[model samples]
Target: MVENRPWMTFFTHVVLILGIALLAFPIWVAFVASTHTLQTLLNPPTPLLPGGEFFENYYRALTEGAKAVGAPVWSMMVNSLVMALGISFGKIAISLTAAFAIVYFRFPLRKFFFWLIFITLMLPVEVRILPTYEVVADLGMLDTYPGLIVPLIASATATFLFRQFFMTIPDELVEAARVDGAGPLRFFKDILFPMSRTSIAALFVILFIYGWNQYLWPLLITTDESMYTMLIGINRMLASGDSQAEWQVIMATTMLAMLPPVAVVVLMQKMFVKGMTETEK
Candidate 1:
């Protein structure tokens, strides 16, 4: 075993390096492409390294090209931020309340309700798209903020996760809370929720990423350019005529759109890890 340790270590290092490279390759390509001129990007296939004229490409893309899109990039970014955060907050709130009630309260047909909600997991958004679209349209919510945020409010996955985490908490703490004259609501607010902070944080990260990356729903619901999310905006930029195509701008815009989730992941790395481990426990 001792003699083979060196080979094992070398093999592990090689695997790790390869994994990192594979993960980073797309990002590297995007970054390099972002720095190239339109002429180079439009040429047969793009080059490997960043070409000269990074600033010129950025300037044209932002100011005078297909990616410009009449409105400022900042405006589009803010629109995306509001939509993503709204979905995140709304989803978390609904999931937490539903999970808490189901897990902690005794009520009629509770298990049935739980199972019914869980059944939603088997159905993809695509499967329900037409009905959901009709509902939103009938509500006159299409092409609006409420349309974007409300449909995502009840996440079955988040409810299941929170329920599982709540179940793992020691019953003794809940009993102690009851002994102190606390009711179910008070106990949930004061005891269960505080203990499940890590799990909540993890869910926030997951939900935020989901909301941020949502493209199809946004595309389908929003028809106005002013209401377009970053993803839709980028797609529009890409689909413009060949003469107006702006690859450098597309790369930069994509990188900008990617930054928020990346920042969230980095900032909450510890909480995210803790949440996963605590949920498992």
Candidate 2:
């Protein structure tokens, strides 16, 4: 039994409410700015409430896109979707395969090989951007879907996660499969892969967000405006060099950019939570 501290409970509730408001304030301001016209937004002290131009602003943003840089919000969304899915699935596939090989196999220098992969965690993409760029250029993958998707696919974090999970599986499962005349590939496909669904779902949410929010790598590789991601496209919407910025359209694009990631988190939340709890335990 616990003591009833009504004042403490009330204080905790107040703090939580304040924290929620603080976090939600940015999205609120963005939504408000999105509904108003450029002239209205440019005026000092922007409106606290939504405006009537909601449909008009979103309609124009969706169809026409920003004044010049973007082709269409829909097209950019398609591009972002492709990139995000590609990165998520690509990383998961390669990482799973690599983890299986490392965890299940006995080979010469196995620890060395594992250590080599682990070392990559210390070196981020930013650190190797120059070398990675040169290699991509050599492979003629620049300005292509392969360019945007491939470079970001090989993830040390994903490998580490999958490897740790694979290690946790009972060796009896592998022994039983061996006794039943099941080879490694068959065992992985029928047993291990199916068992990993929740973990994969959790990883998907993480990788999808990472892929969607990628700005630097994509900006470096994609020279074509058509390949610009929603993040890049959003940045382009801002008029630079003393010109009055398009606050309304930029805010709308910001909101649109947030939708996919937020939706992914909301939809996969249960699976994500379950997987994380199981993984931790």
Candidate 3:
């Protein structure tokens, strides 16, 4: 038997609405600011409603970009999209294979290798960036998509997570695959891959955002304006050294940058929840 309290239900709904408002308020303000002129935004107290300059502001941003950033907003967004997708897929693929080998392969020093990969979690990007940059420079990958994505693609966290999930898969399944005369790759392709869909969805969302927001590595490696990502381009767009900032264009760019990640989350919300919460495979 369950007791239903009307007041508690009402309070819960109130809290949920307030939390949503608090989070959404800033995004709403940004959208409104993006629809106005620089001069209009310069005045104190931003407008609550969207202004009339919606298409003009967005058109200028997509085509002309800001004065400080020479590249068009669309180009920067494309670069970000490429980098984010590459990093996400690359990390997931590599992590999945790495975890597969670690769990199933019986090679000597297997535990040692797994520990080596796991130890890397302690070394954040800042710590090994210099060496990584040198290696990338040596390979002549600077200003290329490979340069932006390759070094950052190897993720210990994803590897560890996939390994844990692989460990949960019953030995009976492995025996069944073997009984069916399936090879290593076939077993993985038929069984493990399909079973890991939800986990992959969750990781894809997270890794996509991580790659999309990467600033320091891309900034350091990319000298060409065409190769700049949304974050780098936005950073460059900030006014400095006696130059006046264009808040409308910046706001418009910000809004545009937010769309892809939001779409990914919305589309994958169900799988992401299952991946995070569901324990039994």
Candidate 4:
């Protein structure tokens, strides 16, 4: 039996509180900054408590955006959301089907194909970005949603993970599906897909955040203000040339940009943990 000691328990709680405070203090400061005016924020010691300008600052950020960022924060947020969702779902779909093909099909050079896909893990987007940009530009996908998402969607890591998980699925299950008159696609849809829900949830959270925070690729491809992501907008806000940066509006936009990814993680926390820790479906 495990014995609980009072001193140990007290120490644990103290550590936990301290860690929470350490992490949350910066976010609190940002929130406080967002609530104050630029002049107020610039003067002397920053306020720890929120100011009365919260609504004004946020409303302006949402509708008017910052002086440097041409697109409204809401439109940029929508673009980010679309890109994130498209990349997440697209990556998962392609990975799932590709893994299924590698695992179930008896095609020639099957192992070679799997290895070929696995090898792509070494070549990240940064490595081939030049050629990729060239292709996108030639196809007239620049400044478009397809340009933002298509080049980033094929995930070697996801495919490898799914393949490993599929390998763990018993051969008996496949035999049984065949005996039950289930075709390959039917078995994948009805059985494999449902069982991989936790994995999908985990990958969704990660890929959503990845797509949302994309900077270099989006910067290179999107010259148009209408297609700017939140990160791009924030960068533009900061680099507004000789004009003083609007601290309140910038902070407000930063806080707004954090919400969708935070919401995704919060809602999928349980599934994400399960997917990461649990191997067996």
Return the lDDT, model 3, position 85. Answer: 95
Stretches of model 1 off by over 4 angstroms after superposition: 5-15, 51-68, 270-281
What shift in Å separates residue 29 of candidate 1 from its native position after superposition? 1.8
Error of 3 at 19 (Å): 3.0
How far residue 23's Cα lies from its native spot in candidate 1, in Å, is 3.2
Task: Please identify model 4 stretches exceeding 4 Å from their true place.
Answer: 1-5, 275-281
lDDT of the candidates, in the order given = 0.80, 0.87, 0.89, 0.88
How far residue 27's Cα lies from its native spot in candidate 1, in Å, is 1.8
lDDT of 4 by residue, 1-281 (tens): 16979898899899999999999898899999999989999896998899999999999999999998778999999999999899989999999999999889999998898888868878887888899889999999999999999988877888877888899899999999999999999999999999887678777777777788888899889989999998888989999899999999999999999888788777888765664464323
Candidate 3 residue-wise lDDT, 1-281, digit = tens: 16799988899899999999999999999999999998989997989999999999999999989988789999999999999999999999999999999999999999898888878878877988889889999999999999999988878888988989899999999999999999999999999999998789888878887889898999989989999998888888885447898989999999999998788778888765664454223
Arrange candidates by TM-score, highest first: which order? Answer: 2, 4, 3, 1
RMSD in order of candidates: 3.0, 2.2, 2.6, 2.5
Clashing pairs in 1: none
* Worst 10 contiguous positions by lDDT, candidate 1: 63-72
> What TM-score fits each model?
0.86, 0.92, 0.90, 0.91
| Alpha-carbon shift of residue 13 in model 3 (angstroms) | 3.7
Which has the higher lDDT value, candidate number 1 or candidate number 2? 2
- Tens digits of per-residue lDDT for model 1, 38-102: 67877867788887877776665555435446554566677788888898889778888999989
Q: Tell how far residue 278 is off in model 4, in angstroms.
A: 7.0
- TM-score of decoy 2: 0.92
**Per-residue lDDT tens digits of candidate 2, residues 96-136?**
99999999999888889778877887887889889989999
